[model samples]
Target: MIRKSRVVLLVLAAVAAGVLLTAGFNVSPIARALLGDKEKPALIPAAAGLRMVPVDIPQLFKEVSPAVVNISTTQLMKFNHPQMRNPFGRQDPFDEFFNNFFGRMPKEQKRRSLGSGFIVSPDGYILTNNHVVEKADEVTVTLLDKEEFKAKVVGTDPKIDIALIKIETKKKLAYVALGDSDKLEVGEWVVAIGNPFGLGHTVTAGIVGAKGRIIGSGPYDDFIQTDASINPGNSGGPLFNLKGDVVGINTAIIQGGQGIGFATPIQLAKSVLDQLKDKGKVTRGWLGVYIQALTPETAESLGISGRRGALVSDVTSGGPAEKAGIRSGDVIVRFNGKEIGDEHELPQAVASTKPGKTVEVRLLRGGKETTVAVTIAEMGGELGKPAGGHDLSKNLGLTVQEITPEIAQRFDIENTKGVIVSGVEDGSPAEDAGFNVGDIIRQIDRRPVSNIAEFTKSAAKFKAGKTTLFLVERGEARILLTVKNK
Candidate 1:
């Protein structure tokens, strides 16, 4: 009876202790001790690590926005219609009746467009796209402070779509420094400042999506693509790197793409900036050689270890290349000490060089490398000469014949030295490889095929499933064609 009474007193005491614990009593440490577990220290975050800081773009915008100006152009467009009434003065019934019999006189219409540009110099030089002010009657530039000035076209390069304009201003203006576009890397942070949609001084930030993009805008299509928001009014605006230097000029955008935009590299603009500013024109060096890209199959057939540089298909008669002993069937590996990586690169390199400057040209002829020093000539010239020809019947399904004196006179071939293709079998390898009936085969597998004996010898060396490159003269241009022998 005494033991039972003691157990009842202990149970009552335990219930009171449980109520105290649930009511916020300090029991965690006591419970741990009772369970033979060690007490853990309270968790406090460490404070020694560096924290992420946001990019400060407001200061950048403040410094660069003043240089970005709005460009508005007025073009006088002409239209002709017989039934249209004149906008000026009253319409005459006699004029309309006379116009019904003959054609109506052309009417002038004013077309207005808006775009963007950036000041490139403190003395009032501005850089913009050529299409913006092309054929424009008048152009006006509006600055950030709401000041307006009349701008004049200094020079335009339609091939690359770049132009330089200038405004006569007495006071010094803010400008942006040109950056080295060749050093621009993909994924680097960039900012685009422009007057998009006529919205004044808009700024957007994005990373460089890619570099050296060929969007087929022109012959020189090296562009910098970015994900930054660029609109119609953004054309000719400057694309700036993080250091506030202008690296690219906004030029084009993909129609359906969300963020895809293209810009002309500033490096190309700098190459001709002095010429545009001073002469109001650009003069590019010309090598007088028609070149094509070297494909892997073409390089392999020629025994070239790597597919690099430009393949010369034709050398203009009396041109710099012809005078320098450079010939067709030669692959140019380097020019003026710069290594040529693509066929497109050579043109840009050559065009950037000064005219009449003698430069070394390294080429691979018959799998042997050689160098020649040649002086570059001014562009915009024409020359022609005829190559020898002969015909042959081989596995490739083409028939060739030698160019006799009578045959040369009939075909208008000068200094006839190659064999002319007389026939190409339908759906044969030759036809599929772009060979025509009038094409003259001058070289086969880099070997000259001047006569029937040479043609027969070269044709005998062709193997099935192996590529055979042919130096063909079609019309005035020399082109290279490759066929996989069947």
Candidate 2:
């Protein structure tokens, strides 16, 4: 019986050994089965084809640091000294002698600032923020090799905060390749090279936190948010992707906020690069329309299904939009075949388009889609205001009068055919509707109100508890306001 039991044990041991070999030398499966343990699959499977590729950050920095540069600027600030006048209004002879000897107490002082930039061309055309070299009397660029060269300001766009500068160099310089910022995905790693705290050629690494961020810096506020340790001297530095391509320009940082930095996308810089190179400034296309975002409530009121377009609040008189038959209340869905996702998108799209190019504008009017061709116009200077006039609509708490020649001259108004708002009573319907003094009432409920008589006639037609649309010309822009009659 002992011999038989040994034979059976030997056979079981052989079977267990065979099982372990078949299971890729894993003894845990057999041991678990012997212990009556249940098996569980891995939470993350190895067969999912996911692999980690280590990045050589040092190698990348070495390759791209040659194109990065440190910028130093000097500006002269002059201050006028308050003159010590005699109580009897008599000139003191001693003051002139003191000023001549002391050189007017050093009226001017040199203000020096430091920033960063990157080379974009072989001939040494560098790109940096406008604020860096905006009012500087002198700008100097220093390369990684410690070679310095005086730079000339080629062009500057203050609205977008980009500046193009050039340095005279006989030798070809290294430049960074511009990448498509629109393709940069969130959470992807990015590298920033700049002169942070005057430490030239400083490099930092982080992932993109967000894109298309608006910090209210200017009209064009689209920025790439990153945590790449950008500082005051890092302004106008280059933000690079893994491929060593320039993706963004480091431009802003939140005060006292850790790891919060903003960059201007390379795409925006590219859009105006040629213009900046050739014309020394950027000329933007204008639509002459005041637009607002289509809110859910506004969309529903307009019988629209989705809030995906820009609601036109007003159209500028004699502007490109008005000439194209685009009216107030129209929702702009697309511009030049590009989809306008919101009100902000429309402005950027329109401004990027070359002026004098006629583009198709797709819009929704009263629940119906339509398209119009508009010839783009160059954006002009500011518009003039209108002077106050006599009272016309007392019930609406508005004081308006006809636009007279004297009033037009006083206010610099070119058009003298509309009714100008003189005053608005507090807490009244007109005041609540944003009726301001100097607003020229051109139309009421789609009817022309050329003068105070016409405005009075139109005001009498307002129904109690009903909303009425008013088209007013304020400065150079036109606006649409709605007032509920009480």
The predictions' CA RMSDs to the true structure, in order, are: 13.2, 8.6
* TM-scores vs. true structure, each candidate: 0.75, 0.77
The digit string of per-residue lDDT tens for model 2 on 1-486 reads 999999999999999887666454454533443444334211121244452221455777898899999999999999886555577877676666667787546789999999999999999999999999999999999999999999999999999999999999899999999999999999877889999999778989888999999998987889999988898899999999878899999999999999889999999999999999999999999988887767664565466779888888777767888889998778999999999889888989999988999999999988999999999999866522322117556668889987888999999988787799898999999998889999988878767778877887788888887777777888766666777788
Q: What is the lDDT of residue 200 in candidate 1?
A: 83
Off by over 4 Å in 1: 1-54, 81-106, 381-394, 397-428, 431-463, 473-477
- Writing each residue's lDDT as its tens digit, candidate 1 over 395-436 gives 888998888899899988885787888999998999988899
The clash tally of candidate 2 reads 0
Highest TM-score model number: 2
Error of 2 at 217 (Å): 3.3
Off by over 4 Å in 2: 1-55, 79-104, 255-258, 295-305, 316-318, 379-410, 421-432
Candidate 1: minimum summed lDDT over ten consecutive residues — where?
A: 37-46
Question: CA shift at 102, candidate 2, in angstroms?
Answer: 7.1
